[model samples]
Target: MRIVSFGFQTWGRKTLQALIDSEHEVVLAVTHPASAQSYKAIWADSVEELAKEHGIPVHLTERADAATIDLVKQAEPDVIVVNSWYTWMPPELYQLPPFGTLNLHDSLLPKFTGFSPVLWALISGAPEFGLTVHRMDEQLDTGDILVQRSLPIGPTATGTELVEAGMALIPGALHEALSVLEAGTANWRPQDKTARTYFHKRSDRDSRIDLSWSAVDLERFVRALSEPYPRAFSYYRGERIEILAAEVSTVRYGGTTGRVVVQEGGGAVVCGPDPIRGDNHGLVITRVRAADGTEHSGAEFFTRGGYLTDVPE
Candidate 1:
């Protein structure tokens, strides 16, 4: 098949590699322009590099400018496969290929249709999450599904883990979807609009932790934002402390919300409620960043703690 690919990040690199391995003719590749200021440079690789290695034409543009469209027209590709491209596709550009454009979405379509689907899934405590390859429409991710596959989100899985898992599934899904398109026997199921859910981009403030929330909820929040991104945090004693790791403990410790009840075994039990069990629960914080920006175990923070007062405004 004569193919053109549009994507950014490691996911784009992996998909381009898959096309090469499958012996498909990838005539061109498109990706977002690199930025030096943002942390995205660490997480994403240049798609242009991959395209050049394959001797394919590459377009690194924030938008599909006239020149990019001309390049696609020159390639005369039968299909355009998009994976994790940051920009929205204009209809004219998407329809340039004869077989139409297919997009790889991180979540099962009609469910998570916007930015940061995997992160939202982790934050919501969803046990299962998946990917979908679908026909690109004017509406975001509201397209006919070409293929779909589900994967388990282990209790400890973070946003990074989920993204890696989803990336692993892309090659197989792309191949299957492409084969169907080539055969003109592509079987697509219409998405259920009534069941669709949407999410907006997460803000910096979204990472803040609320002490009033249940231990279960807080635990999920901490796990959701751990490591790669900023960890969930709260203000204590006029200082910001990042809660890096925590667990819902069985120990019964009574104190006001955000109060430190006990410190033992490199862990500290803090007061919070349990929404699931409908009782007061203790948060076993294992790791944290101190007010002075020093990283330390929960036990260390507990030993130095005075009274954990109310959340600062």
Candidate 2:
């Protein structure tokens, strides 16, 4: 297939690379400029660089502008493949392709429809996340599904772990979708709108740990915001402390919510609820970074305080 591509992250780089590795012809690659939102390119490979390596024309823009639309028309690609795109795909550009626009979303269509799909999936304690390739229609991830495959998330999977696992799955997922795209006999299915879950863009503030939540729930929350993303955190004596690792204890630990119930070596047991078992429980924090940017044992660091709470003095 003659292809035009769009993407702005590592996922996009991988997707475009998949096309290069395939028998299809990639005529153009559109990536993003290093704007404020994408300054974190430390984790992202250069799609533009990769495209040049493959002798493909590259364009860096927010979206398909009038000039870009003209270029897409000139290319007359068989299909337009997109992944991790921050901007909308204009109908003028997507419709220019013979096979239409195929978007690769990280989560199952209708579920986690918008930004941070994987983070929300983990936070919700979902068993699995399905990678989906769908026909784009301007709506955010509400397009007809072209190809999808479910990937299981372990009970204690961290955000970084989940991301790496998804990255490893993408090459195969893209290949599978490409096979369907090439045949031009894709089995497209409309998404069930009632089952959809969408998440908004998140910030470091969103990583704030809520001590009042159940141990199991907090553990999931912490894991969802763990390394590669901002670590889940809480305030101590008006100072921020990031929690890198913690364990859930189903057995009750006596103390108020957020209180340091027990401290031993690197682990500090904090009070929590056993919402599932209908009993009190605790979260044992094993690793932490204090407000001063110093790493410390959770037990040793929290030993000076009896409780960790948002309550005013």
- Clash totals in order: 0, 1
Tens digit of per-residue lDDT, candidate 2, span 222-267: 8888767888888777777788888776455665566664444444
TM-score of 1: 0.90
Candidate 1 global CA lDDT score: 0.79
In the range 1-313, model 1's lDDT, one tens digit per residue, is: 9999998888788888888887679888888877753335535777878889878878888878888888899899999999878776788889888888999888988888897788888888888889899999899999899999889989877777787898889888888888888888999999999999898877667888766676777788888886667678777667777888888877555555666645545454455654334356667788889777788878777775544444653
Q: What value of lDDT does candidate 2 attain over all alpha carbons? A: 0.79
Once superposed on the true structure, which residue ranges of model 2 sit more than 4 Å away at CA? 36-42, 263-278, 311-313
